[model samples]
Target: MNRVKRLIKSVPGSTWAGILLMVFFAFAAKGYLSERNIMNILQSTSALVVLAAGMTMVILLGEIDMSVGGVLTIAATVTGMYLKLYETITVANIMIALLICCAIGVAFGLLNGLLIGYMRFNFWLVTFGTMSMGFGLAKGVTGGGVLSGFDTMFRWISTGRVFGIRTCIIWAAIICAIVIFVNYKTKFGLHIYAIGDSEICAQNSGVNVKKTRFFAYVLSGLMAGLAAVLLLARTNSAGATLGEGYEFNAIAAVVIGGTAMDGGKGGFKGTIFGAIFISAMKNGLQLVGLSNYWQQVLLGVVILAIILYDVINSKIRDKKSLRRVYSDGI
Candidate 1:
């Protein structure tokens, strides 16, 4: 009985919201309950799951990575260029391309980590600046053009099916699983929560605040890079703007999943649900004939509502805590 209660409590509010949204959409949108549509939702949200998983880590530390979109764009663009250069793409070429994408992302991530974590630079300033630089570099490299037309094997990375499941989905699940394990079962994960809850306290307890913060950003960048590969493979094209608006969406997913933006209070499990919810919402809106513009408008409203709810909920929890203390003292 206690275990059941704990399990239920461990589930994030987003999971319930996602279930309700799916129920609503299933009735409202024809064929929404179909396996095809369900698979499509998972496929579309795979990259986002990867991206949000990384965002969860950063947010847990009370920091944000605005440069994720930029990192994805630059990584995808460079990797796309490499793929286009090849007439006959071998497995080796694919491996090299993956390396290129990850390297670019990690390099930028290292810069953000170094500046913000070690040098005591403001995280916002560092991440935003890197975002601009990443986008700029991608634009300059491509000369404001796009790269498209890749080998079949390269495309297969995302589009290929394994046991009737998209490879992208499989990759996302694997990555999310690893992240969840690291976040819950590892020392570093504990440190992330500690720092987010109270940096001074964590520092006094011998947590290497700088190292944790630095690695968090690096992981964020690495995930963006991996997401870039998935996105590139799916779209079969890459450009400077390929990753535009992704940062916001990823952040939205993380926040909507019940991870507090102030940090130290969320995990990747909620983020997976949140990503699926967003994808389902968009898919349902389209099925119901809503325009892209209206979808964007509704999305913004939903994000605001969720954030407001979180704030109110936080206040309520604080009040309850205070009441508990008073009662105990009495």
Candidate 2:
């Protein structure tokens, strides 16, 4: 009994909320719990989980990366064009295209890191600027049209089954695991939390604040690039809008997972659950016959509610601590 209680207590409140959400959906949507629907949810959420993992790191540093969506679009667009140029796509060609996507993403990330981390530029301005640049470049290159009909081999990167499981799911799991390991077991991860908590103090403690911040954004870009590959593969289509609104979804996942906007708290574990929760919410709502517009409104409301809960919960804990301190008279 004690062990069970301890296990329950160890789980975050948001995790319970996620479970409740799934249960509610299972009841509300007739087929929500079916194997097919469950598989759909997992597959659809794979890319999102990967994207949110990187956003988790960025949020952990108390910084935001606004260019992920744009990066994804541009990377996908460029890669799509590369595949289009080839009449017959080979495995080597697909691999090269994958590298192209990641390289573009990393280049943008490096630029963001150099400007914001080393040069001390405003993160918002720099990221947003790059976001616009990425979107604009993709649009110009594609001439405002969608890119589609890539070779089947190219699509296999995401749609192929690996050991009876979708490749995208495997990719997301591998990537999320790596991010979790880095966040928990690495000196770099410690520095990330420390810098987010107090940049000045971390600098005083011999942490490389700038380098950490730089790497955080770079990781975010890398994730976006990888997500673009998955997105392109799943949809077999790339367009100027292919990655639209992704950054919002990624941020929503991280925040919903209990990562503070101010940073220095929360881990990727929460973000993973948060990503699934968001995906489940969307899938369930759609199953419930809600329109996209209503879905957006509800998403905003849920985010606000979670933030309010956190604030109230923090105050209550503070009061309890104060009462204990007073009673101890120490």
Candidate 3:
């Protein structure tokens, strides 16, 4: 009984709820439950998981980045252009492009971080502004169009299967593991938790609130860079609008996975499951004959539900905490 209780506590309701959603969808569309279909879902899930890992860090610090889709579109478009022009994708170009993407994310993130962390501007406001700017840059970069055609090497990154799993899935797993390590085994991770738990408290405790938030934003950008590589390769195309709506999808996965949108709690593990669960839900929806329009609507509804659940749970927990404090004569 103790072991079971511990297990239940370890697995948040958000995580379990997401699991149930997957099961419900799979049961609704048995085809989605097949081995091959499961693999397909994972394949599609790999990139999002990467994105979520980044977003998780950002949100853990009580921030958001709406520019990810724009960042992703630019990364994908640039990578595709190189691969198409030269029949070869070089390690150097890959490194450079990723660096550029990361730098862009960090620069924008720092810009946002400065406004929010230093200047007392609202996080959502700064991020939303940057999001618009990022999208404009995306359109400007692509000359307001889409770019496609990928080399075999690039295509294999997304489509290639080895040992019955997609390469991007492998990459996602590796990155996720690294994120888990960073979250669980580092001072930076502690700082993330501290900042999230209570910024005022963390600051009083000598945590460099500005620096910690900056790190979180940098991590967010890094995740975007990694995700772009896998996403472009998998889809075999890029466009100014290729990654439209991805920012919200990532937020949905993170929030759905049990991470508090308000910050201080949650880690990459929940977000990974959240990412996979989301992938399964979308794939299953398609199998159930839902039109693309309805599928998007369903996603929105799910996001709303997750947000509502978070709000209620938070209120209940706060009440419980207050009651405990009163009971203890606080």
Candidate 4:
């Protein structure tokens, strides 16, 4: 019983909220617990999971990247354009296209890192500028058109199933696992939390705060690029608006997962649950005959509620800590 109590105390409140939501939806929505519906939810959420994983890292480092959606669009556009020009479906060509997409993503990420980390530019302004540039580049490249005709194998990467599970979901799970491991087990991960907690203190402790921050952006870009590829594969088409509003969705998922906006306090476990919860909420609401507009409104309400919960929780923790200090002093 004590062990159970300890475990309950150790888990974040957001996690508990997610559990309650799952239970509620399971009873509230017909067919919500069906295998097919569950798989559909996971498949739909795959891309968002990848994006949120990266966003979690950025937010953990006390920064934000508003350019992921733009980066995703631009990368997908470039890949689609490449495939269109080649007009050939070969393993080598597909690999080359993917590499090109990732390269573009990394390049944009590195630029953001350099400007923000080295030049000490404002994170929001720099990312917003890059976001606009990315959108412009995508529009110019595609001439405001959609690019299609990708190879069968390329499409299969997103659509194919392995053991009755979507390939995209498998890919997302692997990426999330790698990120969670890095966040928990690696020196870089520790440094990320440290820098987020207190940059000056981390710098004094010999952590390369700037380099860590730079790499966080790079990771975010890389994930966005990979997500772009998957998204392109799923849709089999790329347009200027391929990634529209995804950045906001990713941010919303991260915040809903219980990660603090100020940084240094959340884990990927909460994020995974958070992503799943958002997807489930959307699916459940639709199943209940809610319009898309109403679904979005409810999602906004949920986010606001979560934020309020976090604020109240933080204050409670502070008060508890103060009491502990007083008792210790007495």
Candidate 5:
């Protein structure tokens, strides 16, 4: 009984809520549990899941990266330009294009990290500035147009199924697993949590606070780039507006997954559920005939409610700690 109780306590409440929502939807909505619907949800959510995983690390370090959407667009734009330049499709060409996209992502990510982490600039301001710059560059790349006409192989990767599963879903799962391992099993991950808890304290304890923070942004950028690759494959096209507004969704997934906005208090497991929850909610709402505007409103309400609950839960935990201390003293 004690072990079971401890196990229950170990799981975040948001994770539980997400599970309940899935169960409720499965019962309440016709076809919600169908294999086809499940696959659709997984395929559609793949990119968002990857983005959220990266954002989760950034949030865990108590920083925000507003440039995610722009970075994604930039990556996609660069990939499109590469393909356009080559005018051919080959495994080698594909590899080169992917490398270029990832490099662009890392470059922007590194810039944000250096300015914010080392130069001591404001995180939000720096990221916001970079966001604009990235978007502008993407627009300039194609003169505000779309890039299409990739070979069949490019489309196949995005649309093909391997062992009856979407490739993007597989990519998402792999990324999520890597992030989970990094967060829980690595020394750098430990430093991330420490810095999030208290930067000054972490610094005093010999944690490379600036470097850790910098790397966090880099990881975030890399994920965005990788996500961009998958998204391009799935859509088989790229435009300046690609990935617009995705930053909000990624952040929402992280927050709703029970990762504290204040930082140092979340895990990847909850985030996985959170991503699924968001995707499922959106799909379910559409199926139930909710308009896009109404769906946005409902999502906003849910996010607000979750944040409020987090605030209250934090207060309650603090109170309990105080009570325990007082009781021990007495």
Candidate 6:
């Protein structure tokens, strides 16, 4: 009973409920869910899931990273540039380019962390500034032009399959595994929750709040770089304009996955389920012949509704916690 109670307390309603809703809609769309469709949903959600997983770490520290989308574009461009320069990119070349891309993203993320985490600047304000600067740099790097036709080996990461599963899906599953392990099994994850819940208290408790925030942002940026690779590989194109609206979708997935925007509570599993649910929602709507415009509008509305509920749920939990404390004292 204690173990079951603990498990129930660990995975909240908001986290799993959205997934259930999506599954319900998916079933409603077809007489029976197809295996191909399930694979397609997972494959399409691959990049977003990776993005959200990284963003989950950042947001857990009560921080936001709007520059992730821009970082994605920059990473893809760097990889594409390497592919263009070399007839065939060696594994070392790919690793180096990816490193450079992530390093740049880390710098951008660190900038935001320094300004917001230590300097006490507002999270939104810092991210908003970095977002424009990141995009501007991406534009400058590509000379405001779209770069297309990437190498075949590179495309395999996005388009190819392994043992009947899409490569991207496999990558996403691996990322999810890593995220879950780190966030659930490590001390760093505990610090994330501690800082998110209360920075001053966490600091008093010896948690390295500054380092946690900085590392979280770096993780977010690295994930953006990874997603950029996936996007470029799948499309065989790299554009200065790529990943324009990725931040919104990534945040939506995290929120819908049951992660708190205000921070302190949530997990990667919810975000994983959330990413798949959101992708299925979009795909299912398309299958029903809904236009893209309606899909965007509906997705936005659904996310907003779920977020509002999350806010209320947080408030209720806060009240309940207060009550418990008072009751114990009495």
Backbone clashes in model 4: 0
The better candidate by lDDT, 1 or 4, is: 1
lDDT of 2 by residue, 1-330 (tens): 989976774555667777888889988999999988887888989999988888898899898999999999999999999999999988999999999999998988898999999999999999999999999999999999999999999898889998888888898888888998999999999999999999999999999999999998888889889999999999999999998889998998898888988989998998998888888888999999999998899878876777677767777768978999999996
* lDDT values, one for every candidate: 0.90, 0.90, 0.78, 0.87, 0.86, 0.80
CA RMSD per model (angstroms): 2.6, 2.3, 3.0, 2.2, 2.4, 3.5
223, model 1: CA deviation in Å? Answer: 0.6
- What clash pairs does model 2 have? none
Give a tens-digit lDDT track for model 4, residues 168-194: 999999998899999899998999899
Check candidate 5 and list the clashing pairs.
none
Our tally of clashes for model 1 stands at: 0
Q: Report the CA-based lDDT of candidate 5 relative to the real structure.
A: 0.86
Clashing pairs for model 1 are none
| Tens digits of lDDT, candidate 5, 184-237 | 999989899999999999999999998999999998899999888888899888
Greater-TM-score candidate between 2 and 5: 2
TM-score of 2: 0.94
Of the pair 3 and 6, which is ahead by TM-score? Answer: 3
Model 3 per-residue lDDT tens digits across residues 1-330: 989976765555566667778778767887777888988888899889888888898888877877677666666666566556665677766566566655765676677667776777777777787777777777887788777776666567667888988898899889999999998788888888889889989999999888878777767767776788888878877777777888988998888778887788888788887888778778888998899898899878877876676677667778978999999995
Regions of candidate 2 where Cα sits further than 4 Å from its true position: 1-13
Question: Model 3, stretches more than 4 Å misplaced?
Answer: 1-13, 87-103, 113-120, 320-330
Alpha-carbon error at 38 in model 2, in Å? 1.2
Q: Give the TM-score of each candidate.
A: 0.94, 0.94, 0.88, 0.92, 0.91, 0.87
Superposed Cα deviation of residue 109, candidate 6 (Å): 2.4
Q: How high a TM-score does candidate 1 get?
A: 0.94
Q: Is candidate 1 or candidate 3 better by lDDT?
A: 1
